[model samples]
Target: MDEVSPFAEVLGQAIYQFTLIKPLLPTYGHLLVSALFPIYIGAHASLSKPSSAAKSPKKSQEDGYESDTEEDESLGDTHKMESLAPSDALMFPLTAGLTLGGLYLVIKYMGADLLNKILGYYFSQMGMLFAIAFLKDCFAVIRSFFFPRKYSGSGRIWKPKPAERVFQGARDDGSSSESLEVRHSPLPGILGAIPLPHTVRAALWTCREVAYWRARLRIHVHRLLHAECWLSVLDLLSVAVALPAIGYFTFVTKPWWLTNFLGFSFCYGTLQFMSPSTFITGSLILGSLFVYDIYFVYFTPLMVTVAKTLDVPIKLLFPRPAGPGEAPDTISLAMLGLGDIIIPGMMVGLALRFDLYLYYKRKGMHKAQAQGNGSDIVKPVYQSAMGGWGERFWTRSVTPSEPELEPPYHDARSFPKPYFTASIVGYVLGMLATLVVMQIFDHPQPALLYLVPGVLLSLWGTALVRKEVHEMWEFSDAEEEDEDSSVTDAETKEPVEAGKQVSLFSRIFSAPKEGSERPPKSDEANDESVDGKSDKKESPEKLELFTISLYHPRKRETSKLKAPTERGQSPEDDENWALVGTAERDAEPPAKRLRRSPRQH
Candidate 1:
């Protein structure tokens, strides 16, 4: 083995090991890096709801619209609601199959050179992007160290703001469940006046329409590709150009160091996308993967075979030592799959994020506890919208005996420096241990076997010692769904009872006979003009908007006033009649308001 050339000898050894494991294994590792890794990362990101909340605003908006439409169109809306459980179950296998099939096609027709060149180009561009990102982070970290206030000033705690509820009967858990729709004409632009080529104008118009949809799509993609550093639109355009340029170099020159750097950069990005949230999820994810790493590497040669067959930079390749004059290309490269890097890096990032949250929360809590008189640490002030000016302050009740101050919920903005520090320590130790094990066994070892334990021990162990394990384990930016579901089936009976009461009242006080008429009071004749003016003043505010609507102010003045209750009225008159009915109905007792079911538009 010492006398033979390193590349030839290592190749022979890898072949021998693969042969030994082939008889014991049922399948190959073709899709390990290509498909399964991506699918797993995607699934993990999707499952981690807290981290995925930013992406949900657009999704929630779409879902709200869908629900409204479904409710109107279908009586079986509840049954028709889509569940993601099936998608979760099938995501990985589907992704793997598609990816492997695509790879097979590319390989069969274009050859390995084409595949390598494409990957080389892609990773090279990504390398430049990551390198720019890495430098930006490094500068930020350095600046943060020197000017503490600048770093602290940049990120504010994501305090959940209370929203005005459209459904007043709904619980006020410091969240607004209201959605408002406004429709108006687009702002007049000079582009319409300025002459341009018809083709260019058509292209611009097409782009504007596409951008409207892309804005929604970009929100989801942004969460997945979140970079801490801020980049402007111009900066992004430059980056887009730089990516291809970097790829061109990687394809043409193929520098080993540059490729390795790009691999590291790519790893950094993947970690950002799939970073874990809580200790529990991280443990469950990493622990299962730890077992996976062992089974795939030790029990079968799938891991080794996959790493060898994949010529792409899915792994970091370190060149073996050679005599001074030896060519770099000839040197046998030591390969470590990206799974080993990204899995642990994600945990590390999670830990760091959590650690930052804890630090700020503790600081805020301490400040809250120190300020103001009494045993209470926080006194929540609930302001009534009806009130003219001053807010109503009250202490939040903790129990029957005492009230306690509430601290702010930890947010994602906090940097996880401590957890990051610990993970780095673990990563270094794990890498060294991997090198040692490989030397001792004289065969390849699963890098994750060392990496996972190193990360968990450093992160969880420190957490245990500090007595912050529970906080770290259950940390989340998103509020719990249990609170949101307080308006359950049991709570809905009140509305049903109210509906019955409304029915009873309608039956008891039947409408006046068709020929009946009421005598007008002496005051009514004098106030008729005043009432008409008041109606004009109030109509905009009282207008019933069941769906998004655009109303022209000029049309209201030009249109002739008609009797609102006229039987053979147009659609517009019918709307005014409904509005008048609502106003008259509001004069009933407050309790009666609850008793009457909402009128269907």
Candidate 2:
């Protein structure tokens, strides 16, 4: 027999180990799928409707009043009210530490039994609400899969003519708008040529009617599912499906499958709704939690004890085979905490968004360049791939309005997701490393210890390689400003009157001297003040200037202002005169300056 090579021996050993680990695959599979679902779904949703992700402060301010009215009529608010700021990221570790310590102390003193009961009751109620929401979302997804919204309201029976097309309703004037054009295949001509019987013709007519009705039914179902109401058919169906699951989980039995289901739902909801607004915030959060995980897992017994004692769905559990001398029916379990999945999952989600930002930014730059060069840029046409007869029967042949207007990069599937891909690969490797170490040591491992480094290193390394570190650093999801307090600085061409300058200085410095506040303005100064007010009102353009108080004594301000051309002095002479004037004003006592109004100066 030929001797086995070292590589062959290694490969054989790996296969043997994998076969031994086959039973644990479900546990890891659940963890991986649950962790990735939210990121994938959230990124797709944001990319599909890019407008909802971020809005310019200028646009928001300009449309603020209109948006207020629109909001009242809108079905739902999709924009996040609060995002994770950098300050929040800084404080998160402290807050988490306090909570963990408190929980540990409570469990140590008050007993885990009582604490678990109270927590279980609370979580059950909360989980019911979340599960109902999850069910509704699931129903929507399933409904869309069968009767897509893209094909809604486009049935063959309601087909419209090119020139004059009318939907179901007629105009108030009561004129018949148009007639539907029924498109039939050439099968009838082929049948006639073949000299088919009349019964066959009747059967063909029946099939045509069936096809038309199927299209009508599909359109109706799509409309029903997508209706914007609290108690639509879809909601009713979701409630119907959710009620039994809720009852079983609450009353019947909280089986491992049910526990895992609820845990996955909770993870999905959290990642979908909440996000660290920027990569820096995500990194800070992960870094803090990395230390938190290490402390809780290895240094103290709090984490392991709490995880094992708590009967809630906070951690995912997988059953292992009974050990030697144990009861044959007994089950030993392996557990992984939800935090391990969610904490690093946030970074992965942010990476996907960062990818999207880069994609759109590049697209905009290319479009601008093309426009600059006066090139005729062709818009891409999006077409859905053809499917079987059943799929074509349900979905309309007409292209959806949204896709028609969407650019080529609008679809999430086609996006160049180097950062997202890298993070996902890193996560898998880290998780496998964690499992390997756990197996070797015969101890539980804090998954985040490996996960955090894997995610962060992969993301930052990809950024360094791509030379996009600056772009990632600057990317933010927070709204820059709200409409109510929006104000921007404007540069003004108007010269600062000497009186205005003195008044500004007075405000900056202490009040005028104690005994010299008796001087009043003359009639000429009053006339000049009235004339200046008239000139301001008569000017066509009114610019609002936002000022910041600087302690530099107007040195920079003087340098920035243009000298008066009417003075007929050289630039150097004007500069010297301005400096002299400013110095004299500064040297002159505030009392002296206050004796004359700014108009007099």
Candidate 3:
């Protein structure tokens, strides 16, 4: 950084500017992102790829950094960092608090903006890190809710461990044919958004628990008061309204009120996915102008305001191992004011409530019409009222059906999924409500964050989906056993040429053309014929190559004559192969002791 043409002077000057702003960034939490990005990335990578070491192993140690604090770890060893451990999450925040005061001191000694850029780069990397996990969650949500596949072959094969038993029951008592598919957790998607210290994640989770109780309390009141709490319904509505508001803020409008909204979000950059409920609220806010356009627009001036208002002194509590002229860069922002997050969040909530209002009103209208015998207006009374086209607008139909639109599935987890479409509608409404709430709050601003809650709201409707399918299944199961039986028969009639494309990695190491999985000898016992002559049996070598996973290590069996007792010495521990009993041995010749198929000619 120091040696290039005018680079050293330019770099020094940038650091000088960064020093100016570093003091104030802490009030809004952008400083934390700067401080922890590297560690977050390292920790995330290490956990994601436990088998792989850090790129430059020595460099990581020299940096005195480990992705995970020993305390953050517990049961969820690989994918999750948890334990309901609240105190552990506080470690990063507490350390960050102390470091704020020293930030300007370093800035004075080193160049300001120079340090800022350096820190900025790493935090940007953290965003990328979180993004990867976010995308994975996105894909998983899609796979689980839509385009679901029943995976063929065994679920997984861990070396020297028993394979997962996806199919539990055997053929006799009618368990093997049960239709079930195991789905992996979608937790990582929510976590990717809130990359924090262990304690912070825990605290955030704790906060959510608290929020859920509050939401539940509201539900109780609604029920007791006969006001229709409809928790699930409201959540979906909020998301729908929030989405439209988000689109509005992001693309439609840029009112003067927008600046405050954007200013606050950038300042408090804890902008990632959280749980779906809160996320819908947050999504509405994000869809507001603050996130997209308003961000770059007011960023600099906001920093100046932050530089003036934040009282906390900045410092470098943990200094980096320095290069010749490296100085740690910190960030400052406009204000501690949360107008951005709060206003939009409220907007989403209001939208959800309003949608609930409209929904009940519509249902009431529906009941009134039914009482008056006006139910046949929408389309065919049976299809529109009883069954099909009128119910599922997501479905494709130019004309309408007279009967119920969708044929329900037997499985609870199986589709016509829970709240997905409803949530989208909820998200859009949440966005709208956010705008309205902002107007009510004496600030009619339009920023992009307004849409976040709406998106989150969109997911709410998904929760009830499980019940709907379960109902359909119950109906079918009670209706007729033969319907269920037919579905089962369709699944297991294996095709003559099954599984041509898939290949197991282990098979490559074996001799070419060897049978992939020769079934245990017992399953293929020779059949007796009414005639004396024997039937020509198919040889094992000609069996189609299908992969059977190897998880457990093959433990060599010992012979009775040469078995090793406990604490006994082993000469070589070579696998002991037992010679067949004399009666069986006499049935086959010594030169070629092969499986005989009852005298095949």
Q: Would you estimate the TM-scores of all the predictions?
A: 0.42, 0.58, 0.21
| Cα error, candidate 3, residue 466 (Å) | 23
lDDT of each: 0.43, 0.54, 0.30
Which residue pairs in model 2 clash with each other? 499-598
- Model 3 bad stretches (over 4 Å): 1-77, 80-93, 100-112, 144-147, 151-601
TM-score of 1: 0.42
Q: What's the CA RMSD for each of the models?
A: 20.8, 21.1, 28.5
Give residue 506's error in model 2 in angstroms: 38
Pairs of residues clashing in candidate 1: 352-416, 353-416, 378-405
1-601, model 2: which lDDT tens digit per residue? 9999999999998898788677667766765666566556544433322312223221121110112112112212343523565555556667777877887898888888788777777777777766766676665555434332122122322221111211132232334524533322213112223544667645654543322221001101111121112234545665687678767876677777787767766766666566677788789888888888888889988788888877887877776676558997997777778887778877887787677666555554455465574453432222121112222343334333432223322242355789989998888888888887776577889898898889899999999999989988987755333344443211212233532222212334456556545455443344355324332332222211111111111122233344455645333322211111122233333322222122311
Provide the lDDT at 203 for model 1.
Answer: 62
List, residue by residue over 53-118, the lDDT tens digit for candidate 1.
Answer: 211111111211212112112211011111111122234334434565566656656666777767
- Give me the overall lDDT of model 2: 0.54
TM-score-wise, the better of 2 and 3 is 2
Best by TM-score: 2
